[model samples]
Target: LPDIEGELCRIERVRDVLVRRESELRYMMDDIQLCKEITRLKKELQKLVSIPDKDKLKEDREQEEELLLQINKLVETRDFLVDDAEFERLREREEDREMAASLQSKIPKALAVQGESDHESVI
Candidate 1:
């Protein structure tokens, strides 16, 4: 029973690691999906993998430069998107800050004064 419990704990740890790895992969996939070129490269790579002939490999080698160029373009696109997303986040933060400042300004000073007076009366 003790050995079984230890094995179960190990399995649970492995499952946790696998879950985290899967989530990381999902995030990577989502990121890749933003670039159409990477998707095309992936499809080509899959096709290459499926074809198990030396002749096909030689022919595929001819397109390697094109594939790499597309991959690099995709990388550049991803970098631009990351920057755009950061910019959008900062914009949202600024908007939220402005809203909070506006709300704070509108919160009645008269109510604050009345609350102070009430507190004095209670004392």
Candidate 2:
């Protein structure tokens, strides 16, 4: 007759080993899921931190543009003032030259008139 009791014991031992291996595999799979969750959370954190940096960069760009606009306005104003001063200087120089010419012509006519009066008194 076969030893049925021993055979049954041997089969139970094999079943127990399979069940333990399955438990270990389940634990390992749970760990893998936990690792994936941690990685996703880390990525989310990085994005949150970078959002402020992006906003700051946008603000800096706007400020730089404003400064450039101010600089351009100052340059234009300087150019206008310089042009006005140059035009005024030229006009004043032209007026002085005209006044000198008029004075010189009047002086010669007055000298001629004086000489004629003297010659008639001597005769």
- Highest lDDT model number: 1
lDDT of each: 0.71, 0.62
Q: Using Cα atoms with residue i matched to residue i, what is each candidate's TM-score against the true structure?
A: 0.49, 0.48
Model 1 global lDDT (CA atoms, 0 to 1):
0.71
Candidate 1: RMSD over Cα atoms? 15.4
- Worst 10 contiguous positions by lDDT, candidate 2: 41-50
* Candidate 1, run of 10 with poorest lDDT: 19-28
Return the TM-score for candidate 2, rounded to 2 decimals: 0.48
What is the Å distance of residue 11 in model 2 from its true position? 99
Model 2 segments more than 4 A misplaced = 1-56, 120-123
